[model samples]
Target: MIPPAVLRRLNSLTGRSAPITLHGTVTPRMTVLASVSLATFLVAGMAATQFRSQPLPPSNRLARDEALRKSVNQLEDQNRALKTRVQTLQADVKAGEDESARRSGAAQEVKAQLDEQKTFAGLTALHGPGLTVLLHDGTDPNSSVDKSLGWTIHYQDLQDIVNVLWASGAEAIAVNGQRIVPSTAFHYAGVNILVNNASRLSGPYTVIALGDPPALAGGVGNPDQLAELKSRNRIYGLGFSWLRSTRLSVPVYDATFLVKYAQPLG
Candidate 1:
């Protein structure tokens, strides 16, 4: 159907009784457009009413900013107080540590002195000009025919020799390159001599001692140890030889010991 505006123009031009349906001259496209416009207006009115439902006071930017600033300042004051407390605690701890450090330093110095004395007492390894004593088995390749006569030096020989050397001016001693303290031991494991329960030693057994050569030589001049030594040499034909050297190295004691009954004496 034609629109009313177009029908009116036609009536003015040709003078017909409006060539449109009695219902009106609304076209299908025009009717759709009018329905969409009416729906849009109703939706817009509903949205405006919903927005105006909750009317608000005017914006107060300055008041909100002032409140935020107050909150920030309060938080900063709390943070500052906590930081000050932490600093004070740190200072107190530092003062206590400084006082304790003085005593700790003194204790460390004492320990260093004690360790040096122990090292000098042959509790640690040392190297210097000293002497070496070689104790060999009496293995005469040309004349040994008796099987009962064991031509080897026993542990007793080794102990006696060490005692004699220590009684002399020998400062330090080692058997088979093993350091000897008062706790050192020598025993027979089958046919081999075990030193310090760690190393198996065989002849010729080497005994190294560190001391002043002149003092050691003069002090070890007793012939009683010599007679016992000679008797063994005559009976078993054991070999004994000693030499003073300008250089010798004594090793550290590597054996472990457990002391269940002893405590440190003040």
Candidate 2:
């Protein structure tokens, strides 16, 4: 049995107040064994507590993954929509370009037509191969051959020659540097013969026509075309000559339009 004083002292040191009873004889060895046994139990219990598994808190991983999936889907949808919009814009741009090209082509065609009209209206200068007809007064001053006007170049002679040139498909004609248009007038003005009513043509009038050189020359020199002129040239020594040229140029008509009441005939 342990002494009461010793047991109380042991209780005071260990801070224990419960009653301690031993069945064996109280000995130092027994006390030591009891202390070691209590220590081992406390150590084992602490170790068990330290290594014990605990339930984990609820996980948000599944929710986070779902949110990420939704975000990626939204981004994909936006990308697809952008692609569609881009394709539509590209088609529209292509259509616009095509329309612009078509308008440009039409504008070019219209410009070409206007230029052709201007050329045909004698508003533009012309240059090509053709013939030059020269007419002058006759040298013979005989009273019988002259008949007061037979020896001199007249407006009728000019009119006849111009008609022949026209029949020969002359593209352009000029008299003494004056362009002959559809409105040109060939008539007598006092003692001098007037051409285009703007120029008084003197002797040796030069008439230039733009056409096939050989054709124009042949048309002017044809006896059938100028039968009366040929007879007069033989009878009264009237001067008439025609020559072919590789290059010829006709000036643009400089006179103003004077047809006030007259509309286009054809």
Candidate 3:
């Protein structure tokens, strides 16, 4: 319906007014979004690498646990050894105490036996009816003197009296308070009579003999030794007396003598 030139110009206007379409290439906004996405991905990867390189706390914790376990094992072993040692020491102490008690009991038994033996042997003092004989030195003025006689009171006179008293079954005897035992000795030392290793026996030498007075009196009556003792007493101014009493006490004698051959055997 229009002219050719007009139609051409109307078509041109219509084409200009219509929207254009791109079919072969991407847009600038799409490229920019892709680049941004790639950069974000690289940053995330770098952060993961740093985290992997750092040390973990659990590794140190495991090592500390292992060390603690070793220390506990050492402590347990030490405790076991100490327990064993304590047991050994306890046993030793008990054994020592037992041995001590045994020794103490043995010592007490021995002491009791010794005491009993001493009692049975009559090793203690005794007091009963007895006889006493008195003798004096011839040189003393307190003695009786007969100028016509000759002999002096010698050591033999005292020895004879002691022998007669023993023969009369005297239980205990003492001369001048010197107790007569089986080991008692009489000897002369420098013109003096020594009894039991002692001297200076002078006037009023009282000999205590513990026994039945009647038996002792019968043993000494009218004996030859008595006649000789009387003769000496009259001749050389010696003194003599004999008496009987109801009670006279004799003391115990304790003596310790060394033995050369004594030794301890294993």
Each model's TM-score, in the order given?
A: 0.53, 0.68, 0.46
Q: Write the per-residue lDDT of candidate 2 for residues 137-213, one digit (tens) a residue.
A: 87656566446667788888888888889889899998889888878888888878787767787777889999998
The TM-score of candidate 2 is: 0.68
**lDDT (10s digit) by residue, model 1, range 60-158:** 997899899999999999999999999999999999999899989999999999988786555788888777887888854455566644467778778
Candidate 2 vs candidate 3: which has greater TM-score?
2
Per TM-score, the best of the predicted structures is 2
How does candidate 3 fare on TM-score?
0.46
Candidate 2, superposed: residue stretches over 4 Å from native? 1-83, 263-266
**Residue-level lDDT tens digits of model 3 in 105-198:** 9999998998766533446777899898877766634436545323445667778887888888788887777677765667766656777664
RMSD of each: 15.0, 8.9, 16.1
Candidate 1 vs 2: which has more lDDT? 2
